[model samples]
Target chain A: MHPHDPEVTAAITALDLFAGLPASALDEVTARARVRTLGRGARMFDQGEPVERAHVLLSGAIRIAQAGSDGGQVVLRFIGPGEIFGSVAIFTDHLYPADGIAMVGSTEASWARADWLDLIERYPRIALNLITIVGRRLAELQDRVREMATQRAERRIANTLLRLARQAGRATGAGTEIGFPLRRKDIADISGTTLFTVSRTLNDWRRQGLIADDRRALTLVSMAGIGRIALG
Target chain B: MHPHDPEVTAAITALDLFAGLPASALDEVTARARVRTLGRGARMFDQGEPVERAHVLLSGAIRIAQAGSDGGQVVLRFIGPGEIFGSVAIFTDHLYPADGIAMVGSTEASWARADWLDLIERYPRIALNLITIVGRRLAELQDRVREMATQRAERRIANTLLRLARQAGRATGAGTEIGFPLRRKDIADISGTTLFTVSRTLNDWRRQGLIADDRRALTLVSMAGIGRIALG
Candidate 1:
């Protein structure tokens, strides 16, 4: 769709990079964007592909990951609505480092590389905002590295749950439910533990009444307990 | 020395963030910068300090690290000549996430926060360059996390040595010498192993003639062998 579409303008303006741009500039950006809607498990971009555009998720979620030579996949992060991904290519080498896959139904607004670079040049604040965003991501990634290096599997999983809860938790009758659709393997991959370990830990938590778990959702029955475990 | 000093101007212009600026702009940046020489083992800034300036290392090396509450220290990475450090604080919450310590006799050129922000406003390329730097850093940190999660101690240390060799390796008669003052504890910290493990591994490597080690220098005697271990 054309960037001039009202829907596109609203979405683009809401983005931190495009926020505060003049209406005319926003119109220009909107005019230069292409929007795509994808089904669950659809691949948005492949690792090592020349990154030709920057994407802003309009709705739903996207998983960014890298596949190892041994067929093991590491989930780098999950991008939710209003967050931009694949834009790192604009500032550095123009190649995607990981595969961007759609999680659930997703809508993405994309801008061509040249157009996005032009916008950044015309609006320096966009570049500044991007630096801030990238810096925060780096800091978070470093924290994950530290956790993986020093923390135990239990503490790692506990911290990961708390982090996910903070990002996508919803209050429910049972407890604070994690709003994301996460599988056992996702938790295992994220926490650097085996699937069996995650399963056994969750079973233990269920028995202890520390958490309520289902196939697709998890409820933190006792955040204090989880915090204690995370601290340990 | 004044900002117009040929030495300062030359150094400033060499930085990636200032690479393409006009001489007049370089002079302006130089005028706003303060150059300091730090002795070996000097502390540049502590983690959690309010970031007040951006620094560009002109000579020697700097080590950036974080200290744990339990007195464990993690060596994040080392910065060498012409690389910018301590600038991540400029874009985020203005707080340094790690301590910057001088590894050897080091000369750094620094700009106050306000002046650096003004410089970035006047030159958008600086912000773009920073994005590239931070993006690469995030990618490297992610690799560290993945390694810590999936790799064993031997493979992790091997990979760490390879990385450091790539970053700061100096060709010598014995082999490709890593040009940094790395202790056993430093390698252990970087590889998330213990000093005992690192020392044992080094002793094993020395016996196998796979690496040449000393108190202040480490030479890779066989990159092929190290690569094999790292691949495992």
Candidate 2:
């Protein structure tokens, strides 16, 4: 809650959007933040809610997802700490298009929409940073669209696992483990496949010594094996 | 291309990116534009090429597509008159991720990357307009991701047709005619289906009096029918 709280300040400074600013500018940004803490499995915001603030995750993970009226969901992205989310809607229509659900106990800082606009106008670097972030996403989504059209389920899942590993993986003695509670539903949603298929494929990979998992986190035991499958 | 050429001046002013600029500012933009014309089936740019210029379509149509190394292609978006393409890479990496291919005889105006940056920096409204455009595309792509995960092929095709019509439709007595030569291959690429599936589905819709088409264009015969399928 305090602007100068060392933990909050450190996290805020680590963000890519604030990368080049001097200490004074960082202080100005830190002062504008309103912090919120989310419990695991709780939503930070729901789809169709009125837009209010632009958020940056400080700690833990968030799944940006949308559910169709017909019941299935798509995981648009998984947000890690020191990353931005919930800002896109502010630039478009003033409504959230997806839910920001905390997959773990997470804390984030948000600036009111008016404040965000003002900051970007003053610190144009922030606007450029935001644009770069969105552009990267556009490219990734284009790749996903191609995979959906051409690749089978196994290849899609393999690609998803490899991508997730690159994004949030941490080194472990056994292998590189994805650093959060990645559920089967998330894997299914990201790969555009069924839950049953996700479970079965992961199990098969486990049996072949390609992966390792516990109740919460999964690790890639053989990145080469997954890469081969993804290539196919 | 003379900056004050009435045709070029009119076309540049009609663009949403230049929506709020004064005549003087529009002249500046027009002055920077280098015009190019494409023959039917010509490529404006190819995937992985160096990003040189940002383009705005003046007339005719272009399909932005990416081809996988494995030989399948995905149509990313169909560009209509006054639409922007090949600019996202300017904000991300300096390489194009898709090929900009003319679907018919086409004309476009482009600005060198440095000039485009100078313009946006000099005119912040242009920056905001660009953000709004990319934000809108992000929303559409999210909805598409959801549909890919949840909906069947027929629904996806219906949605694509409706979206295309809304983007580039011209009203005719028979219906709203898609304002370009939308090929069956384009439909297959956009809808994440096979050529056989797109042709079969279009034939089925034609027999049911849901749509009408000639050699070059498709027209919506009963928008309500297509809307019904899209809703599912």
Candidate 3:
């Protein structure tokens, strides 16, 4: 088996969903996964594309999004290392319901649906893992739904910042610096607000000494205060 | 095997994720499922309960919701017959993230975690189906996220009516009537808007001859126009 390949082994091992699988199952999974490198701004898949494989983020970032009829786009979620996307469409036998684009230079690992299905049949643990993964995603979406229904735009923005900080933040003297490379529009997309609103809110937060932004980096000044806003 | 018992079958079949399991597998499933009845406005599970069984809706409606710190509640989704809702916490190993309440008199089917895992082992098709079902829910959440980010309140209200009409609507000469028993607050909860906003939008639609609400039943007078508003 080519399971000795470092990249394949690394990718499978990194995925938290596959944590409990035996080494043998890991080898089997790696054998079926095909690794591909992507460049920034590359379209990984378009809306309505046939979903033949599930893509896992091994390195870098990918944005799952939808373009509306009004020429506007919405960013659904940003996938980072160890996360799997496209598994849903692969199982459903339908075209992808959304589009994915590379947010940075990235390496993605993918598995054919047939091969993955075969593995799921062979390993029930993987099935459980998948269920857990999907369940977590559903819970996250439910949270988002709640936020959209009840929370104000500024509070939603604060919650988004806090969530991102926890997921991809780096430590600095100022606070946890969210280091993900995101444009203001990308932030707007993630937070479910307009770019103008994002700009205005950020400016307001900066004036109030809650946050500071430098290029793609944002440093939180008061996580406690941000939490208060999110609770609103 | 008691397969003919609608309560048993309904709970077992509520999950599209568990479809295609053989009778023997289903019998095993039936052993673990508890049938229960709830009165209107009764809480099936609270927001912070320890989630042990995946609750399957048999008859009547359940609102999966999140309560705001300010004592407001946002209904995330309405659960109907042949649908599942409590699987999210099972997958995440977290406390119940939302409260589920019976919107009307209701019956439910529920299964323990051990039985759920056993079924996954015995029937691969069911596992795959669950994956697909969760995936579709994720896609729907993505759509909602988009609406919250870019769409205005008017458009959100329009899209919500279109969605509810599709979900619970019945045909009539006036138009497709959303027959589900709903309060203005429930509509507001589902549409992610304030009750005031929902009231104003409905009034506007009524005045413009686009919709008619007689008690709890909402009739669409102009679907095409509603679609235009939703698309914007």
Candidate 4:
């Protein structure tokens, strides 16, 4: 693997927020962060582990989850390329609150916590970028909370499918298919329901011609209907 | 009214993040921030209003809400003394997504947006502190979202009451009484339920000797029972 290749350099340079930073600042960030790779199903971090760095996804997908007291796991969120993870633990002075695991063939990432603190001290602009990033995530979480409170299970499922489709789906002539690897149980965790419920709901949607489910893949047959359901 | 008097000075100083700033920084922040006294029911800012500043609640309580499409309002959160509001709108580069109104007899607050940016430029420490603050709030929102998704209405009500009591309650011989000036509808909005549901569940708790409803007040008679319900 060309760990120090120019393509990686170009990708990092193209990030809008970091684009304006001087090469020296970027080098400082690069100096403190090390690139790592993980194979499919490999554990990236476990709940209650010491959180020393925040990971920025370079490629592939990661599932962030927390174990419930009832012997089940709850998926908090999914992190894809160009996104950051492990921040909540950094600020709270606690162990990582969730477990992160690779969900695809392979994944690559870079991380820095101590370096980030030093970088923020030297470049306040980075801190401002972080504030905006964290702030947007906060708004998204608030919207999700609102949805959970007000929407029915069917609507929530529809909305989840729409969101995932937008974030990680590949378009086909017939329908858009989500590319990220996921199981029915993972869908249930993310959608905040039971696997049985998720199966039943997917079956109902299939019968209604709203979606086509192939056990391992989901295709949206009627995006407009999903939107209507989400609104309802 | 001593709008910039010792009480306000002490409160602002305790923020720690702002305490070590240079005199010029403090002056800049103070110059742009206006102190306002809001009477009960007065709207601090409405949904879609341009967000110009972030408010620090000096005293009293404020409810932050959004108008639902169905002509109802959803209370997102409540801000008490020492807490900050308006960051969500400020960072998003969007108009206020929710409305903020005084929920008590009166509220005293100070706000500054432009000046705060200047302060961040002057003192990166303040930006770091602000990041920590925003991150903490994000964690709390995640917890609340998880609760809404997993918990039943009765448990939600119980947890909400317990949380409010801890935040802004007064102790009486009978029990801890939530002192915030909240209407039944406000509680319903905060708890993500209809007013009818809130009233019904509260009445059920009262009948079961789990809580005492004192019209504008609420007192927990069985904290253990409430904890059990919340944990379930």
lDDT of 4 by residue, A130-226 (tens): 7887887787676666666676777778778888887677888768888667788877877877889889988888899988877577888888988
TM-scores of chain B, in order:
0.91, 0.97, 0.87, 0.85
TM-score of chain A of 1: 0.89
Give candidate 4's error at residue A166 in angstroms. Answer: 4.0
Of the candidates shown, which would achieve the greatest TM-score relative to the real structure?
A: 2
Instruction: Sort candidate 1 into its docking category.
Output: medium
Candidate 3 achieves a global lDDT of 0.79
Q: Each candidate: what lDDT?
A: 0.83, 0.89, 0.79, 0.73
Candidate maximizing lDDT:
2
Going through the candidates in order, their DockQ values are 0.63, 0.68, 0.64, 0.51
Model 2 chain B worst lDDT window (10 residues): B1-10
User: On a 0 to 1 TM-score scale, where does candidate 2 land against the true structure?
Assistant: 0.96
| Runs of candidate 3 exceeding 4 Å displacement | A1-4, A172-174, A203-212, B1-15, B69-72, B172-175, B204-212, B219-225
- Tens-place lDDT per residue, model 3, A140-226, is 777777777677788888888988787777889998887567788888888887789999999998898898887867888889878
Q: Among these predicted structures, which one has the highest DockQ?
A: 2
Residues B74-134 of candidate 3: C-alpha lDDT, one tens digit per residue: 7778777767777767767658878888988888887787777666677777767778777
Model 4, B78-134: lDDT tens per residue?
888877787656767667878888887554555667766776777887777778778
* Clash list (residue pairs), candidate 3: A192-B149, B17-B130
User: Which stretches of model 4 miss by more than 4 angstroms?
Assistant: A1-3, A15-19, A70-72, A106-108, A169-179, A200-222, B1-3, B16-24, B68-73, B108-112, B169-179, B194-213, B219-225
lDDT of 1 by residue, A1-232 (tens): 5566677678778888776678887777788889889999999999889999999998888888876543456877778777889889766778888899887888899988888889899988888888888888887776676777677788888888888787678889988898767888888887888999899888898899989988778999998998888878
Error (Å) of candidate 3 at residue B100 is 0.9
